[model samples]
Target: MFKPFINTLALSTIAIATPLIIPIIAPAHALTEAQVLERLNGIPVFTITDDKGAPLLGSAPQKGSEKPPQVLLFFLNPDDAQATLTQIQKTNPAVGSKARIVIRSMNDAYEVIKKNQDKKDIAFQIVPAKASIESARTILTSQGKPADKLPNVPVFFAIGGKDKEQGLLTLEQNGKQLVPFFFDQKDLQSLIDRAKQQQPDVANATKIQVTSLFQVLDSMVATKDNKPNPDTERFTFVPSRNAFEYVVKNQPATTPAPATKK
Candidate 1:
């Protein structure tokens, strides 16, 4: 089925073992470039605010300027999202403007921002967008796949401009399991350039490798040649705002505070 690709898309692993008793497998159909673009644009988008309740990024790009290509990232935990943002700031400062980095979180943005309020310069926008998150869950469920499950690590969609077409990239856990993923400004620039082109080479996109999330952390980092096994952890659903409150109240304090983004 497309489970391997789906796992790659969600940054969640899946294990497919051939059973002793063979079950009928359906033939999979490749998505046309147009259908892929439509689905990419159909991915829900919404507005978000900072800790002060001021709006940050809106549902769509600003008027008067052509919409920039976007990178939509979904994070299971706020801490992971913040950690990734910190790495970006330290490694490559210009990634924010290179592509519109939109981070989606199930936790409330106000509290998520409050947790890292000491770090003022993080470039990404984290929003507590539950409806949009649920929409993702619905689509996955209807596909006869696992219901209510999403990627654990950062799941990235490189969305093109003009037509809003997209390519998928996921940062699966590195072989050492020390870093979830890494990327730099140059990587974003490449995606942005691809989006700007009139006719993107869609076939080449599907074969793209799922690389390390630590490209920002270490330039020498190497990627695993093989895909990760299916992640066994089950997805948990909670009210976005409520998750933030719980995390804020109970988040461990023993870990030393991280340095702010430069």
Candidate 2:
């Protein structure tokens, strides 16, 4: 029983806001372990660790279970991890001061989880950025759909096609057409705006679609062998630029060598 923890408030919000079309987004299909891990590669996730570089674990009570399960928190945004660290520092300075943020690809985390899948003591939980969640909710509401159907971090993509049928919009890069899914809504919107200016005809038909990171990963696994077009295999995930910048800025400063005595 590997349970991914979602806080009570967020869980309640998801319950009320999830649209009826969730099943369509995340179809109930069995995916092999290799498929799952292959899809997770290159996606970055953040975590907090002690000075010794071990992930900090937290326990949350599980319904119908006597003992609360231990959870390792994975953050979509470095800022969120920093916020958690700040709070820990306020309450427990000694422990917090020694804690640091670590960046790892989602595949790296999944590999570890897969190795310990049989163990019942711990589970991995994803902590989405509040801003991203709010953006997703707003988009869903505007479309007259459920506000928060995504289970994990929301991914935004643009779609446009002829008639009733629609498909992901592709952008040309280095002579290649690539479909981009963004972790940040604002980034996706920016691309949408540029596309609109460049192709007015296509812009009028463009629509923004929202899905969860987990759903996207699962979809890759499900569709791996049956891609409708070559471009479908070129799907690219665009991480939050701000989060990347934060990681670079906070990287441990390199130690300088002592100068020889004059």
Highest lDDT scorer: 2
Write the residue-wise lDDT of candidate 2 on 109-204 in tens digits: 665565555557776677777888888888888888876464467888877756555566666555645566777888777766676666667666
Tally clashing residue pairs in candidate 2.
0
For candidate 1, write residues 42-144 as lDDT tens digits: 1221222233323333123546765542322344334444555566556656642232223322223223344554442332343323343444455456556
Which prediction has the highest TM-score against the true structure? Answer: 2
TM-score for all predictions? 0.20, 0.75
Report the number of clashing residue pairs per model.
8, 0
Candidate 1: residue 42 lDDT (0-100)? 14
